[model samples]
Target chain A: MSSWQIIQQSLPLFEKGFVLTLWLSFIGIIGSIIVGLICSLLKYFRVPILSKIAVIYVEVSRNTPLLVQLFFLYYAFPVLGFKLNAELCGIVGLIFLGGSYMAEGFSGGFDGVSKTQVETGKAIGLSQLQLARYVVFPQGLILSVPALAANMIFLIKETSIFTVIAIPEMTNTALDLIGMYYRSNEYLLMLVIGYALILIPLSLILTILEKRVRYGSFGN
Target chain B: MAHSGINVLFEGRNLIRLFGGLWTTVEIAGVALILGLLLGIVLGVLRTFPNRLLRLVLRLYLEFFRITPTVVLLFLFYYILPRQLGVNLPANQMAMLAFALWTSAEMSDIVRGALISVPKHQRESGMAIGLNRWQLYRYVLIPQAVSLELPATVNLVTRVIKTTSVLMLISVMDVINVGQQVVEANNQKFPTGVFWVYGMIFVMYFAIDYPLSWWAKRLDKKRLERANG
Candidate 1:
């Protein structure tokens, strides 16, 4: 069969895999943000041992490879009596890896908030939680917009690694097509372009958002 | 009962074997860093080329690599490039080429940012002092850019080290691949050696990367101090 015919036949398979990839990325983006925000808050408040644990978590996660993390969860964890399937492992690994970077971003954003603004919030009879929710979080979010966007993009690209562990994401789907149809050139070309189509727009949107955030001047 | 798998880490030659894998990781990362830095310098210069066409082409190259996942790029170089070009480049070399391409894009940004951030008066001073273009770059521009680039470049080195682990996908016998092999070999004897083997690999990478990141932070602090003072 010709390359075009092969792609046509494989379209449904690719679409299924593409949807899985999107779902994984979506969960990764939201889950990592939540994890990152909590860690950042703990570090920001210096909550004693929890703060230190957060520091270690961020450091170890940042320092090591995401692939190692995935392998540890998918392969090694069974040995430790806590087994997650390959897909869950991939999502968990992405969240853990992305959260470390995002935690740094969040903490940096919180730090960028003026000391006087925080003090005034306390002075105005606001509880710490209220201050964080109403005053600090919004400003921190604005300051962290660029980092958050970059982290999300990084997480999306990272979903590609799922292929290695037999999680049927887009990359795995493409690999399977190539193996089945012997259309290595066409399949690889299509995969690269497919990823570029999704990724390029995300990056471009990041660039535009960064510029807007810089000009918005809320953190200042 | 839960975490006993860690015991196999210190049992025999496993630790030593992991360290050997670490060495392979370093070799891949080291070769890629040097080549990528060289390629980056060229791309950086081209990024600010006087010719608009060259700049546009370089921008596309930069964007294409930046957006594509490193693993995909690795696959392309490993499988497709040799077939297309009719050359039989080995996987290790293709791995290096892939890394060079990816890292070059990042490094170019660092170089371009450092170069552009040089004060305009400094460039004027170089021209006023009658230095030619090459001399200006060599003496005036690079000296300043080096200071700005050093910390970021150090951070990039750590990132490259972490990224080299991906080469395991292509069956490159880097640290991760080696550790996986050892784990598979010991599968029958230890049965639960996966945690020990992979854990050891993690610690080895952490040992290498943590100090580098700490040192990068120090360089960043020093750079900030120099800028402020």
Candidate 2:
């Protein structure tokens, strides 16, 4: 088949896979954010044993390869009597991995907050929870938006690995089409474009946010 | 699970084989890092040049590598590139090419950031001291940029080491691949060896990466303190 005909025929499949990639990234990002917040807060508050556990978790996640983590979940989990479908395993693996990276981002954000601000919040009779929610979160969120944006893009790129376990994300869909059509070069180019479509806009937004952060729009 | 699997891993020459795999892993990472550093310096220097067309092309190259998944890149190199080009390269060569591509993009950013962080006044001062453009970069600019980029480059090396795990998927016969093969052969005799096998792989990675990461973080913290001034 001509390259034009191949692209026309493959566009719909690529769209389906592209949407699947976005959805998986959405779930992974949401799940990771919650996990990251909990872990970072644990460390921030120095919550006894949980803080140490959180540290170890972050270290382990950051140090190991995502592929090993995914493989561990996919192959080793069932051996340990926890059987999740490949998609769930991929998402969960991503959450744990992304969460660790995000926790570092969040902890950096928390560290960026001035101690005087915390003291001022306390002086104003704000409870610790109230202080954290109202005073600290806004500052930290502004500081962390760039990190979070970068991590989200990383997570989206990682979603391609789901293809290995048969998740039918963009990469896998393209792999399948390539096999079916025997147009390896064309389809691979298409795959790169498919990813760029999602990532380029995200990166542009990150640059803008980073600029805003540096300009002190949210206040230093 | 099975005690035999644990014993099997420790027994015979299996441990030696795993270590050999580690050697292979390190070799690949070292090669990629060196190649990437060279390529990154070229690309990074080109990025900072006054030529708009050159900058535009470099930006596209950086973005293409940066945004694509490493796994996808591996597939393209391993599966597609050779077939399309009508030339057959070995799997290890392809793996190295893919990794070098990824690392070059990362390293270029590091170089660019480090170069940008150097004050323009330093360049002016170098010129005032009768330094030519080359001397300005060599004597004044690159020295500072290299120091600033050291910690980040170390972190990048650790990352590349971790990423080598993915090479197993392409049958690169790295540590993970060798370990998997051993586990498969012993799986029938020792069905519960999955955790031990994979866990060991994780530990091996951690052993290599954790200390390096810690040192990088320390260096980065120190660099940040200096930069903050």
Candidate 3:
């Protein structure tokens, strides 16, 4: 079978898969950012034992492969109770994986905010919470935008691993089509092209977003 | 049950066997890393060539490699490539090829950044001294670029080490795969088996990557101090 024919036949399936991929990546990125921000704030506030636990979580999650983490979450989690659907398991796995990486990004961004900014906010008689809310957090967001975008791009590509647990994302769809048709050559080529179609635009969009964020003045 | 499983992992020769698996993982990572550094430097330089076509080709290569997941690439090389080429390769050799390609793309970006960061004045001075392009790169550019590149390169080593675990997916039986196998063989132990085995794998990775990360940080600190002082 010609690659073109295979793609023409598989286009709807690929579209559906692409939608799932985008959904997984978008949700995972947002979820992870929230998780990372919360953990980062906890560490930043020096919340006693919580900070130490956050440190351990970040270290272990960051050090290991996402595949193993996904496997543990998907396959092993059920054994210990707490059943989850494949998609949910994959998203949770991605959340843990992306969250750890983003913690570093958030922490770095938080650290980059000058001490004087906080002191200045204090001099204006803002409460501790108000100081961070009105002054520090915005600057940290701006500082972390580039790192956060890069992490999100990585998370999108890493979502391909969800195929392993049968999530019917782009890669999984390709694997299934291949299995059914046995058109290894055509299917593999379409798979690569399918990924490239999603990934290239995502990367370009991210680069543009990073540039805009860098150039835009956000009322500092 | 947990104690029995732990005994199996730690007993007479099992610890030694696990260490041997760890050694193989290191060997795979170390050899692939060295090869990748060399390939990356070359490709990085090629990408910056005065020739636009060369730059375009390199960009395409970089984009494809960068965007594709390493596991997919591994599957391609291991499963598809041999069938297409009508030649079979051992799984280990295919893993090496896939990783080398992936690392080359990553390292090339680092190399390009490091080289470009060199001051323009140095290049001008080299040209003024009648040094050819090759001589300029050798004497003037590379030495400085190496210093800038060292920290990123060390971080790349950590990436390569962590990525080596993917080889297990293709059945190469690296450290993680062995851990999985040991856990499976002691299935009745449930989560405890996985916990200890994966914990050991985690420690092994930490032992290697932690020092590399430390050295990279130390290098950055020293470089900053030098700039200030």
Candidate achieving the largest DockQ: 1
**Model 2 CA deviation exceeding 4 Å by range:** A114-136, A212-220, B1-4
Q: Each prediction's DockQ?
A: 0.75, 0.71, 0.42
Every candidate's lDDT: 0.84, 0.85, 0.80
- Separately for all candidates shown, the number of backbone clashes (residues 3 or more apart, or on different chains) is 0, 0, 0
Cα misplacement distance, residue B23 of candidate 2 (Å)? 2.4
For all predicted structures, in order, the TM-scores are 0.91, 0.92, 0.87
By lDDT, the better pick of 1 and 2 is 2
Model 1: CA > 4 A from native? A112-140, A218-220, B1-16, B225-229
Tens-digit per-residue lDDT, B1-229, candidate 3? 2464346567446567678778878877877888888999999877766899988888888888887877678778876777888768788777877788888888898888888888989889999999998898889988998998888888788778877877776788688777777777666644455655665676777777777776886896677566545
lDDT of 2 by residue, A136-190 (tens): 8878777887778878898998898787678889999988987787888878888
Instruction: State in Å the error of residue B129, model 2.
Output: 2.7
Better TM-score candidate (1, 3): 1
Q: Residues A1-220, candidate 1: write the lDDT tens digits.
A: 7878877877788778878988999998998999998999899778999999999999999999898899889998887689898888988999999889899889867766766678889999999789989778888778888778878888888899888799998889888877777778877877887787788888888889888877754535
**In candidate 1, residue A21 scores what lDDT?**
88
Candidate 3: where are CA atoms >4 Å away? A1-4, A113-137, A216-220, B1-5, B11-17, B188-192, B221-229
- Give candidate 1's error at residue A55 in angstroms: 0.4
User: Comparing 2 and 3 by DockQ, which wins?
Assistant: 2
